[model samples]
Target: MNYETFAPHPNLDAIVKCHWILEVPGDMEAPKQRVIPDGCIEMCFILGDDVKRFNSENEFIIQPRAMVFGQITKPYFVKPTGYVNTFAVRFYPYGFANFITQPIHELADKETPLTSLFEESSIKELEQKIIEAASTKSRIAIIESFLLSRLTDKSIIDNIVTSTIDSLSQTKGSASINSILKDDLSKRRNLERKFSKQVGISPKQLGRIIRLQAALKMMLNKPGENLTQVAYENEYYDQAHFTKDFKEFTGVNPKQYLDNDQMMLSSLIYSKD
Candidate 1:
């Protein structure tokens, strides 16, 4: 497996999180990767064997070649159907709203094709262009060009959302929803409505995911860190409560998560972005 990450262009700081490329061979077997709840959305271009998202024991959905995965509200599972090769864009929670017109929330549980959100012919060309633009400038310019040309609604770029995001990042996703909204209840409510409509999940839920994300990275990076401390550090209720949330997000106990055969995809924000 080979993984690479790149920083976003300064101009796209609002909508773009970062760019990444991942490659894993087909012969190698990996554990089913758990898809946790994250505050953000993703757009990916598959360069190899397809991936499968299981809806049930027997039901699954295949990802399209060029797809934008909307904000996920609940946990899900993904396993590569064959060798996995992909390049993707990780967007902030509110980012996709600027580029996509169709309510992203409606795509909560599925991998909808780009054509559904954009013009069919344009999507084909855009996909090719993004893949072809490997350099940082080229990639950033492509994303910016898409928004500037296709998404002319200047009002979608919001200052309040950016301010809230700044504070949210500083706290490592542990900020209180009430505190975050205390000063502007109306603005918070409006954000909630817009978030649900555009991002597919509530702000509070995204915050929890963010906190879990922080804890997951800490636990992974600092192997010696104890669970009780991890829980307390992330502001969970208690050790048991913390374990429960971790298991819910990961589908495995914290102690067992790393050892699992599945390569679960928790929020990789801390590591990549």
Candidate 2:
């Protein structure tokens, strides 16, 4: 398995987290990869065989070759049918909302085909262009052009939502939303409404996911650290609280997550910038 991420053009830095590519060698077995919530959204294009997204213990459907994966609250599994080559655009919590007209919350926890989000003819044209691109650089250019063209009103970003998320991220989700908005208590309801519309999740939910990512990064980077210490450093109330949240989003205990093959993909992605 190979994964790499590239920074977006300077003008899009605030809107796009990064552009990434993943490939699973045809000669190797394609293992089921578990993906957890990270308070972001993604637009993915599969350039190889179709992948399966599990909806239940024994049920799944082939994911569309071109689709958008919305804000996920729980962990999910995906496995390639064969060789896998994919190019994806990852957007920050409030980034993708600028490109679409609907309330972002409506897209949570599911994959929506690109045709549903854009004109069918345009989506079809974009997919063909991406597939025909001769190199990764060409693909990146194609995707950026499409995104630039679809960009909606950039003024839609709310200052409250932006500052709240910045605080949550800076503190690694340790900052309480109330404290972040203590200056104007009356704006809490407005904050919730803005977050739901632009971030696709409540501020609290996004904070939890961001906090989990912080913990995961610590665990991955410092393999020698113990869970008790990890929980303390990350500001969890206790070891149990940390473990419970870890399991809730990752579908496994911290101990099992260490060096677990199923978690390799997610671990690699998080371990890097």
Model 1 Cα lDDT, one tens digit per residue, 1-273: 777777776767767777777788899877667776667788888877889888876688887989988877666888888888787888887778878676767877678798888899988888889778766467657766775576566577566666666667778777876687777677878887777765678767777778888888888788779899999998888989888877776677888876665643443434444
lDDT comparing candidate 2 with the true structure: 0.92
Which RMSD values do the candidates have, in order? Answer: 2.6, 1.1
Output the lDDT of residue 269, model 1.
36
Error of 2 at 110 (Å): 0.7
Q: Over 4 Å off in model 2, which ranges?
A: none
Among all windows of 10 consecutive residues in model 1, the one with the lowest summed lDDT is: 263-272
Candidate 1: stretches off by over 4 Å: 130-144, 183-188, 264-270
Clashes of each: 1, 0
**Residue range with the least summed lDDT across 10 consecutive positions in model 2:** 24-33
Residue 210, model 1: lDDT of 81
Compute the lDDT of residue 107 as modeled in candidate 1. Answer: 78
- Per-residue CA lDDT of model 2 for 1-273, tens digit only, reads 789999998878999999999998777774688999999999999999889999887799999999999999999998888888999999999999988899999999999999999999999999999999998899999999999887757888888899999999999998898899986778988999999999999999999999999999999999889999989988999999999999999999999988688887898899995
TM-score of each: 0.88, 0.97
